[model samples]
Target: MFGKRNGLFFDGKITLEQGDPEFIELFSRFAYDEVVNEPGAQHPDLDDATRSMAILATLIGCQGVDAYEMMLPVALETGVTPVQVKEVVYQA
Candidate 1:
């Protein structure tokens, strides 16, 4: 389920509002409802920390450095350690 501020369970630093605000909703639906919420996408074995690390790796692989920077705080808050981040980045 999406949060109240945006249609996302997690905070995404991507600034889509500068161009088309509606895309935010569209993207949220696509990412959350269509992707993240997909039955096969569900991984009960993946804990929050593991998930966060994977996301960080994926961001780095995708060249989303800005988003990666912004997401660092949230990642730590969610119990992802600095060392884990570094290792994930290195792997990416």
Candidate 2:
């Protein structure tokens, strides 16, 4: 399904040596294609930066270090400022 290397998040940089290929494939499809590609609502009230900050706060509260690591880049990419990210972590 990953026709292009750029379409895959980690792409050729990381290897999923420990997990079952079937499970990985399924999760990748669901997470990237289904969840990320779908925007069920048009929440003009919450912009991308705000959503990123909320996600950061939730990640901090949940102690989701790995997920935070992964999402931090996305947050920054979506225009979340470094100061705001730091503030969210500090507040959490």
Candidate 3:
């Protein structure tokens, strides 16, 4: 989280806990801790770039353009290249 925090988060919370505290809490607990950090959900063989690409594809398929735009920079920072992102979009 800290490594990807520069643009995606502010002071340990996304958008400085904007809107409602509950939203931040739920997202942090469920998305960050419970799901993303779950031991069983992680793959030692899959690098960050691969994971980010897959996530971008998922977001595109889900029609999460707003979220995709928000996360694109972070994905790049985490090692996902622009070409990979484009291919994911192309594939979708």
User: Which has the greatest TM-score?
Assistant: 3
- Give per-residue CA lDDT, model 2, range 1-92, as digits (tens): 34335434345443452336777888899977887667853367978888889988998889899999999999999999899988898889
Q: Tell me the deviation in Å of residue 23 in model 1.
A: 2.4
The lowest-lDDT stretch of 10 consecutive residues in candidate 3 is 1-10
Q: In angstroms, what RMSD does candidate 2 have relative to the true structure?
A: 6.8
1-92 per-residue lDDT for model 3 (tens digits): 34436445534654545547787898789987888777857788988788889889999989999999998998999998788888988999
Which regions of candidate 2 are displaced past 4 Å? 1-19, 39-42
Question: Residue 6 error for model 1, in Å?
Answer: 18
Clash tally, candidates in order: 0, 0, 0
Better of 1 and 2 by TM-score: 1
Candidate with the greatest lDDT versus the true structure: 3
Displacement of the residue 53 alpha carbon in candidate 2, Å: 1.2
Tell me the TM-score of each prediction against the true structure. Answer: 0.68, 0.63, 0.69
- What CA root-mean-square deviation does each model show from the true structure? 8.2, 6.8, 7.6
TM-score of 3: 0.69
Ranking by TM-score: 3, 1, 2
The models' CA-based lDDT, in order, is 0.79, 0.80, 0.81
